[model samples]
Target chain A: MTTATTTDLYPTRGTAEVLTPRQDPVVWGAPGTTGPLRPSELGDFDRDGFLPVDALIGPEDVARYHAELERLCADPAVRADERSIVEAKSRDIRSVFEVHKISPVFAELVRDPRVVDRARQILGSDVYVHQSRINVKPGFGASGFYWHSDFETWHAEDGLPRMRAVSVSIALTENHDTNGGLMIMPGSHRTFLGCAGATPEDNYKKSLQMQDAGTPSHTALTELAGRHGIRLFTGQPGSAVWFDCNCMHGSGDNITPYPRSNVFIVFNSVENAAVEPFAAPVRRPEFIGARDFTPVR
Target chain B: MTTATTTDLYPTRGTAEVLTPRQDPVVWGAPGTTGPLRPSELGDFDRDGFLPVDALIGPEDVARYHAELERLCADPAVRADERSIVEAKSRDIRSVFEVHKISPVFAELVRDPRVVDRARQILGSDVYVHQSRINVKPGFGASGFYWHSDFETWHAEDGLPRMRAVSVSIALTENHDTNGGLMIMPGSHRTFLGCAGATPEDNYKKSLQMQDAGTPSHTALTELAGRHGIRLFTGQPGSAVWFDCNCMHGSGDNITPYPRSNVFIVFNSVENAAVEPFAAPVRRPEFIGARDFTPVR
Candidate 1:
């Protein structure tokens, strides 16, 4: 155990906070060499650690995705699969993981030029899905996520070595201000906030439903939110947000009648494949953090 | 991988059946020196592989357990727990595992002499909880389990070296003949049926809710049922049945209005602790199959 900890790069669950400086560049490619985004849009992504695309998919595509989401939720086999996480309070499906493998519709969605090209532009390499899911926030009794960076979990538990991943959340429903929508901290991706609690054995089992470990402490969240003001993403159904893996993000519970849902896809550069977890006792299951690093065509 | 297979004592998932003879004794102790049972009762258990206790607990204790089961099923936190497996077709709680640790009422129940003494007598040593669960087969759409032996899974996935384990299922509800009641093959404990098909990665995740892999083939089940014959357990609430780990058993779906619930506990000999899985890629989580070998006093 001592030897294992000695070589740790991003040590978490300590008495005090250890903010590791970001070693990798936010956007790997610059200007004309990138996939589709203009130089000005690339500049905004590099500066703010996120870029909101007003029209990622057309209205027809959004409707198709919404129908697919409903079908997946209603399917008994999908609910029976361990990958589908149910809401804590209600019978509604909270999230269905490994969506690409579960549905051909989602499998095709991941390969789309609008989704895959932007990821290739940001990471500057052929990418594979590290994770993909449909996060559903049903109208009543939907739970919220706490303030935490995705990279913290991916690194500590999924064995993701670098922050060379981008998460694309394409809205399936209108993300009203009142509905529980993603809230990310602008410019907070540069520093990795080392968390302060040992990850429990088989942590993924509980953490999927309610993440307690590898979360930012109250002090760390307060400092980061103060340094970089929070940004709540509210848009029409087809809008999408591409954010850095290390950005501090969370969401509120949807108490309103309107539901909020998205097709969340994470593309990790093939160059940075997963290894053994840096802090956790074991790597999570393939459905949560994929080990099959086959590059997307 | 070749070296690992050569060393495997009980190989599974091949094209043909591999009926390994039982190397361990079903009832380890002789008559008078055993923990609680008489000579005739011990002989019956050795022959039939199962013995039923008419009244394992009083009516008041049964009421207490019923109340506790109701409480656990309704609690949101318990439902949120990954240990609580939901039904395939509905949001109903199917089974809540690690019951000894989950509820104080259950913790006390395991230590009761009527339960633990018989386990010690049959195992002929100090015993520990290899697994404990409250299986709730609620009427209307609750699923049934196909025929399978518990030891096949314990040996393949949990890495238990020997078949020196006993499972006690104490009925919390009156198990009517129409409702789903446990059916076991008499004298089936002598042969260890090495199941066909490779145990899928993270099999417990799916197997807990509905097992597919690591199960005996239809041919094997047919032969066993033909030879040994089947016996269905239907009794009033508080009745308990003690069976060897290797016995082939399964239950039907509770289509009747009455519900069938049981506090199922498995006790393994302290000497027969777990190691790396013999057939599976990895051992199951501690909640489903415990690794801790601390003797229960």
Candidate 2:
């Protein structure tokens, strides 16, 4: 494979430093270990394969990252397709990794000792970055993403990292039910629901079922939230939710005209691993620019 | 934004000529002139917002594309993280556009009168290439990707283009239920289910419902398939599927140890509109060389 340029592969000198203490030297007990996260807080994570941590970042830091994103989105050098431009222009723009590069706030959030300690306790080892992305869904301009699991897209491998993979999303905005907030399927991750594996012939029939079922599923979940007590993580800027990647999740359309933004970072263990970027039928242009990027090893 | 080089934006001299014949003239008809698509065929796409056409490209062509993809994947110059390599790799690899760029096979497939006729009937106007992509899902080596909708990912501006869009995928391998296969929610395209307005709070609870519900909505659909007398579309390599962008669709895991690959191309009207590539948040180092790419317009 082609090698990345020095600049593209290594962290820039101006890269942001994570302000939180690293858990590298600290070995903490399970989720309940003294810290912000409680063992019960991670209860869902254990049974269902994912959990959402509330408000990992604060509003001031969110505002700063938003400002940086605004600058980047405004850069003329960045040429996006009409659709992408429209999406970016309609929302507050920011790069997930860029914030980590420029601000100690993001770095600290990603490296938060409590979060990391919990990750290790739940996952059983150190986790590495699978990828990081920024979500900028502008009011009325936000695209309603679909609901699906992160693991379903892969070609199963022998040495694949365990299902312990987790995706942590840090809300830079107060994500509510109206502004294109993230939606997820709770316990779906726990069981290996045999792949639907619809055939070309079966696709049409299966699709109909999915559509019909989607509504009731939504209602069922809504009702359960009211009864069973659903948690609304109205995280202040800088706060985040780290959940299992396998959990079914998606976001609704942005109802308000304001931008609803967040940063999503995925982590997986490196031991006995054979992970690569998920392949799409098409390549994303922005990602192409960072093809040479590599984490400091 | 940095402008794409003319060479990278437009097809090379020989490439443009190759695609000419496939450029079947789009026939416009009065709105509602064409009869509605078959109800059984219309799954989530009809309800959610999209449709699917099976076997758009033949098996032979799919095999050839697969061979080329294998070569590309094995190429040392292709690294997931290297932008410069990705740029160069683009030239060596066979893009869907390039396939039509040099071969009559692709052109014939693009202009397949049956497919175009359907587009004309559905869109009420002539359609053209919005973008074409080569999706190579290498087994074991690939990472799991997110579940999302093509239309929701990109936004449109006033006077932009019709919200209706179609994607034609040509199967490159004999995909079975065992291997990761495509799944869809039928009839989802037409109705704006409550999900359209769901939020983060909805997501937390929705996830819980999925866990409580015990099985995914798709499971119900699978059982209903036979009861509804609906037909599945799994087939040989030559088969293809055409569907709406807004349709709820996803692929299953490649349980088998082989790659599940395919070629995806989208056709859209350019009238009073501009077509551009989708911009993603992460940057890949390889696409820098592609800076020279120009649009066909």
Q: For each candidate, what is chain B's TM-score?
A: 0.96, 0.53
* lDDT digits (tens) for residues B89-166 of candidate 2: 223222323334334445555566655666555555566655455555443222222223344333211111234556
Candidate 2 chain B: worst-modelled 10 consecutive residues by lDDT:
B15-24
Best by DockQ: 2
Q: For model 1, what is the error of residue B154's alpha carbon versus the real structure, in angstroms, after optimal superposition? A: 61
How many Å off is the CA of A262 in candidate 1? 0.6
Worst window of 10 by summed lDDT in candidate 2 chain A? A9-18
Worst 10 residues of 1 chain B by lDDT: B1-10
Poorly placed runs, candidate 1 (over 4 Å): A1-8, B1-297
* C-alpha lDDT of all candidate models, in order: 0.85, 0.42
Residues B15-126, candidate 1: write the lDDT tens digits: 6669998888898865577567887888899999999998999899999999999999999999999899999888799999998999999999999998999899988889
lDDT of 1 by residue, A23-129 (tens): 88999865578577888888888888999999999999999999999999999999999999998778789999999999999999999998999999999989999
TM-score, each model?
Answer: 0.50, 0.36
Off by over 4 Å in 2: A1-36, A48-50, A78-109, A112-115, A154-160, A193-235, A275-297, B1-297
* TM-score between candidate 1 and the true structure: 0.50
Q: Residue A172, candidate 2: how far off, in angstroms?
A: 0.9
